[model samples]
Target: MSTDLQWLLLRKYNSYMVKGLPEGPIFSKEPGNLVNIHSHKYSGLSNSKTIDVSDENGVIQITTRKTASPHTIASTRSTSNIRARSGGRRALRVASAPAKQGYRPDLRRATLARVSALLAAQKEPKAQPAKKPRGKKTKASA
Candidate 1:
């Protein structure tokens, strides 16, 4: 008999690379106004359109705020769609590099489980007050 799966249907990319090979002449054939990502881009300083140039630089820096590249603006928002847990909380576990592609029912389930656990953990415990003295009244009450 075929089994059923209680799973979240999410669209995800087989691979997600935050920073690609850098955006300029591969090696600066001639260093002059080459477009390159700023050093701080990795530190979350990337505003919609923030730019920084080095004192010893020769490059053009266009950020997401501007149209550095059409692909940058049209990029997928986040990895949230990959709810199937192709890799849930990478830092939580250690493993080899992930595959390029191919459906992975196993990872999908794990991801689903991780998310479910997180949601479950967020639930507040039923308000539990301390039990009061029973079977005897305090002298102060009397």
Candidate 2:
């Protein structure tokens, strides 16, 4: 079967399931061979799975499975480290609390009052005590 026809069949049947293209050329002169490729995104891990596509009796079959190679493990570990460093999970959890409680008019009023107070303080100058003359004060003419 032509690669174009294979691609069309794959698209028609498995477009939602499989996103990225086959690792190498699809069909590549062989009609009944398995082509493996990594997807662009899967389970929050990028390029983490090896997808197998085979033409079985003109039916395009796609299978996606995770590979247990040293590189894949190391990449997963680095991804976890990045997430920890970014504090994404913590920020999401912390932000969700306020959203769940809904808007609190009391809190909003209090925050606005504090902010306006700060702004007013910044706009108004503080009164400075009068300074005495700095010139040397010798004994005044007797």
Candidate 3:
């Protein structure tokens, strides 16, 4: 997804980070460029992209990619494909951090963002109208 488009998706999902990283990965070297993602827990990469990291300065310009179309019930196989795509893309764009940086992502924030976004987007089903009460029976006019 393009920068504007990703922002739209985030809005649709409601101010939350998609997938499993808090606002995706951040490279200390650059401040406004994005890096791709792979879930260590799941053993694969994701198709989505991250925000751009600028210079050592604290500013960052976020961006994203389509990765996957709007599909419900995504299977494990397809999800794995997304992860691989994400990892490869990241490898190309950003250089890896030094060993001493000790990269540990903010999983808690990511989970909260995803859950809140999803819940807010969910629409409740419409309720049925109530039936009217019937009047008492009357004798025949004959």
Candidate 4:
């Protein structure tokens, strides 16, 4: 009888590294764990992209893609590291720093000048029209 089961695939590299020595990369397969799978998915490295797990004849097989080179993976990881280090909010703050540096003082000065002009205008006395003097009543002769 043929049975199908889900397995978790992992790409592992040799922990030991020597200068000027060729590195050996290894692939590992483990029993499928939902929690691990979810975590991997959340990390943006899912089955098709980074991990490769397959089952043949009720046995788990761990394999690596020939197209993905070590250099390419290293470059991709470096870029991700850079992004994680900078962070989203920190990058925004850095980008807006220059604009903010010169903006506030100028804005404050302009606001103060406008307010002072308005206050001066308000303090000036308004001109009024002169009123005509009323004539005294005169007695008329019949």
Global lDDT of each candidate: 0.27, 0.32, 0.29, 0.30
lDDT of 1 at 51: 21
Model 4 agreement with the true structure over 16-130: per-residue lDDT tens digits: 2122324543222232221222233311233322322233433322222222555676443211111223343443343233225552222233223322333344344879887
Off by over 4 Å in 3: 1-105, 125-142
Residue 82 lDDT in model 2? 15
Task: Report the Cα RMSD per candidate.
Answer: 20.6, 24.8, 18.4, 29.8
Per-residue C-alpha lDDT of model 2 across residues 1-142, encoded as one tens digit per residue: 4434545455334423444466642222122112222222111122323222232332323333333666675443211111223343442333233224452222333223322333343343779997755545433422
Rate residue 126 of model 2 by lDDT. 79
Error of 3 at 70 (Å): 30
lDDT at 78, model 3: 18
Q: Write one digit per residue (lDDT tens) for candidate 1, span 1-142.
A: 1111111111111111133466642221111111321222211122222222112122111111232454666562222122223343541222111211222222333333433444344445899897766555555556
What would the TM-score be for candidate 3 when compared with the true structure? 0.18
Name the better of 1 and 4 by TM-score.
1
Poorest 10 consecutive residues by lDDT, candidate 1:
1-10
Task: State which candidate has the highest lDDT.
Answer: 2
Which candidate ranks first by TM-score, i.e. highest? 1
TM-score of each: 0.27, 0.18, 0.18, 0.17
Cα lDDT of model 3 by residue, 1-142, tens digit: 4545544443333322245456755222221112322222211122233223222122111222224455732431211111222343342222222111232232323422332333333335579897655554223322
In model 3, the Cα lDDT at residue 47 comes to 25
